[model samples]
Target: MSSPPLPLPHLALIGAGITSLTLSLRLTSLGIPHTIYEQSPSLTELGAGLGFGPNAARALEYIDPRLVEIFNQTATFVGTPSPQGKELLLQEGKAGDDKIWIEFLDGTKQPEEGEELKPEFVIRAGNNKGHAAVHRGAWLDVLGGLVDTRERVRFGKRVVDVVLPAGSKGRVKILLADGTEAEADGVVGCDGVKSKVRQVLMEALGEGREKGKCGYSGKYAYRCLVPWGKAVEAVGEDRAGVSSLWMGPNRHLLTFPVDKQDEKFLNLVAFVTDESQVWPERGPASLTLPATKADALGDFEQAGFSDSVLQLLKVTNEKMDKWGLYDVADRPLSKFYSGRIMVIGDAAHASTPHHGSGAGFCMEDIAVLGALFEEAIARQRLTVDALEDVFAAFDNQRRERDQWLVNSSRRAADLYQWRIPEFLKPNSLEKMKADIEQRQEFCWGFNVGAAVREAKKHMSERLAAYK
Candidate 1:
């Protein structure tokens, strides 16, 4: 008699963000069949700069080193913008309301002197040491293009709910927005912070209404982009080529460069930790709220930062949007799986952007998950009925590490805003520089390939228990 087909012959992915795409890459490599559902009409990314470290870059080797290649090709070193075009950028201000002055927290102005700081002053806030930066839109475009089965990605199909079939070997049924339904042997939630699949799973497990909800992390970011020529003219050439993180009490500002096509753009992000400030939208955990340049300027003035930073924001094109930093730590998940359903990436361990390792951590999940699936298929030991092993192995391997990131990012933010009492002394700046360097080592030291190997081993050990 012919052998029965594998249990997970078909899998369904909800959401087409980076996590979904990365998982698709791995499953396709193993010749696993799956389909991706995206609520967005098209694959597009908003926001400003994105980055990951050297260790996270290596994780791409598991899927395709070409991902790292695409990143390197499009990425601009933080702080470096084209100097030859600085004059033109300053002249071609988008709104024609460009301010020509800069101010600093040190009570001195740029192009004027007041306690000059070295370039390393940028990373003194305990940041990713090997960070490589890229435009959010550009990186998304590259990853979306690299999918071998683009046709498998379905757009405008929002997943509303998911339920497992009554029988053990039956498929998991997924309901979509248009009242249509799809079935798969397994389902993975890559739906990000506001995940519908996660909602379904949480509701099923009786985890309570508030157990898995995302909430504001008591911080908001004023994210904007300025033309290359203008940023150089405003911040000057020397400061333009080196990335800097200005950390003050309860606030921090960072600047980096994004290379898109032939033009280089400077990405400016200013984050504030204010309990009094509220997002314009009082509705549920919305992605972002509309913002104005004047709003950002007013916030900066209160932040007590230099006017030089304000000069760059003044010339940025379009209305600056203030993104409330909403993370999952409000209801942190102690477990990443339930039955055959699993939540990955932001849906599982959403973190603050303080470490700049969020994207990197998502990729690591894909690597380890792929490894587990690959091993099971090879052993012919994985079937829909054996999903206990899949869920157990993934959570056992990933739960603490990913959640640690959630907690670590919160701690890092506290340090950056000087909320931590240990970093509050007069000599605390120097102490922070030393202390954070060691603390940040784990952020860059994680090896995704090794992580996958370890997960695979745990999966086998767990599966054997059933026999």
Candidate 2:
């Protein structure tokens, strides 16, 4: 029995960041032609470093096994803490059997070593080593280079509006900022946190308040990247691989390595409470200090922040990059697709960086999109109507997961905050471990290829109605 030929979709993907790049690679592998539009006149690395977990690493593995190999070789994975610190927090794995061990700064163990540690709990110190930290620009460059030049990732093309053809089953038209237009069978909106395509999708659903509403998490971040040589000289070489997190009243500071060089670059993130919810804001370059160098360190110095963090702050010639940390607090959207247009990544569900899953979630989006497109084309099921069903299924399978991440990240933010009560402190480590285990089951357990298969099954039933 001869199989029916697959339908070919002319796909248009907006944004060339990590998510878009991943999708571009996947589309290339499936021989599905696509055009990518990026708003930045030129593509450049925006942030310093990113921490990727097993879930994100697995998603990348599905995209290209070589990517995983490269990441493992070039990146640093911190799994076990050195004898330098005290143990304060613990995290357990999914079965509540495996435990992460940690020593906090004060040398106090919420769960002392040799005690019966459950797999469900996480030692805050132990969980620290479970992530692979890499430079943001370096990681993006790796993915961007993999994209074929023939695919034409067009820059300087900010999407202003999405034009649907007169009839429901018409070509998807994308309006560019420069007054030009491009047409395709469907559009994938990976346009990031402030997405224009999302606005169009919301309007189509007649959800006005949802489209206009923006999240305000009452948190802000200050980020700076410092050279490795300077960091090691200030913080010492032994502290290079370990990420130091100092928790204080209503604030915290995180410092970690981004590269593998002896004098590698270190990325610093300072999270503080700020009532304002604006984006693209700049933080103060310098704080008031007395004559002494210690005085100049201010609150950060008093908190026992590593010398590397202080050095980065002192040497930063420009104001640190500051932005509001916002997440969608409302329930997840019921729909993520309309007509030939669909939303992916942060555009669909923005979340806090507490769990370091922003890029991970985006990668997951790309993997799922690639798989669905492959099946639809293979089954000869690709069409305007067919794509709608595929998009709906993609939304159906993904919305709940994305929303879960959003809520989980919010909870993590609360747990990591500096002001936890004393009584709560003893149980925090055990609870933290348990939370990690649950997170692994929910997040790391996701299978993009399987999800696509399920989506395909659902899409097939829907497509039969139109036949």
Candidate 3:
């Protein structure tokens, strides 16, 4: 008699964001059959500047060094050591006075007469200290070029619903908005903040009705990218090249460099908390509304921001749009899996961008997922129950860290805006500095390797028990 046919593994990936693309790279490397379904007619990324912490870079390394290579090629580094070399990365005892990550300054008050303005504190590059940022759309374009072969990714296919299989060997049926259906062994939801897949899983698990929705964050930002030369002239070359954060009451502004095509640009985001009006409920469109340079300057007119910050804002287009920030903190998910379906990236644990590590943590999620799938396929555990085991293990390994990010990010925003009650008193700068240091280390020092190993071990145990 002929030998039994080898089991084939296939997965459906929802969304074409960085997380899904990174997972696609890993799955392709492992020879796993999968397809990416994107709701848009073509892959695109909004927002301006995006960065990776040390932990995120490490996660990419674990997934495949090539991902890091792509990152290096796309991202812009501040001080010495070009992106071609790895010297200015997250290293120990390598942080110098010149290798700065971000310089935090007070924007609420001007300096005293004859006193030069200085940073309240600086987070340098060392001891898991790295920050490399790029234009979101540019980075997405590069990653897309690598994974999207036209055949592997199907565009304009929105996942309306996912139907889980009743039996272990049966396929999960995915219903699309365009009146089509596809089947796969498993589905990974990477559909982002307003995820339809998350809603499906929430309903399936009988979770709260509000758990899947994104909360308005009570804040919004005016973002733009100015030409490098204009930024240098506006804020001086030092401020133009290095990442800096200006802190004030009810608002803050951050600036960093990003390359667009052959020209370097300074990406700026000015954040303001609106206590006067609640964010209006709107559909999942741009998440932005029209504003003018006058509107932006008016928001900060009374904040006592430095001349440089005002100049940076003035360089933006005459007409601009302010993006409303949103996250899942209002209703954090306690679970990430239901049946063979799982949520990753923003779909699972969307957080405010205050920490600047959302994408990094998402990369960490992809690393854990890739490792578990690798283990499952290696052990011939292609059945639905086995895949479910893989997802369960992933949840156990990732839930704490990812959810902690959602909460910590909110706190970070408060700290930047000087809204934290405890740190409001005089002589509290030291306390605030300590808090920032500890939090940064906690996120930058996460052990992706151990997480991967632990997740795979747990999946192996589950597969053994199932047998």
By TM-score, the best candidate is 3
Provide TM-scores for the models.
0.87, 0.79, 0.93
Candidate 1 is scored at a TM of 0.87
lDDT of 1: 0.71
Residue 202: error of model 2 in Å? Answer: 1.2
Residue-level lDDT for 148 in candidate 3 = 54
TM-score pick, better of 1 and 2: 1
Estimate, for each residue in 1-467, the C-alpha lDDT of model 2 and write its tens digit: 97666556788988887787888888778777789999887566665888775567666766766676677666655542322211111112222222232212221112344442122222432332245677788777788777774356899899988877778777899999899999999999888766777777887777853552346677766776767676666556645445655444455666777773443677777766653434443332122111322332564665555444465457443455455676675535558888788889887888878767788888777667766766677667776667777788788778888878888877665655544464256556666556645664565456555665676676666666657
For each candidate, the alpha-carbon lDDT, in order, equals 0.71, 0.64, 0.81
Which pairs, if any, clash in model 1?
A: 79-240, 79-241, 86-229, 102-307, 102-308, 103-306, 103-307, 103-308, 104-306
- How many steric clashes does model 2 contain? 31
Clash counts per candidate, in order, are 9, 31, 0
Cα lDDT tens digits for candidate 3, 343-445: 9999999888988899999999988988888888777775555777888888998989999999999889889998889999999998888888788878877
Better of 2 and 3 by TM-score: 3
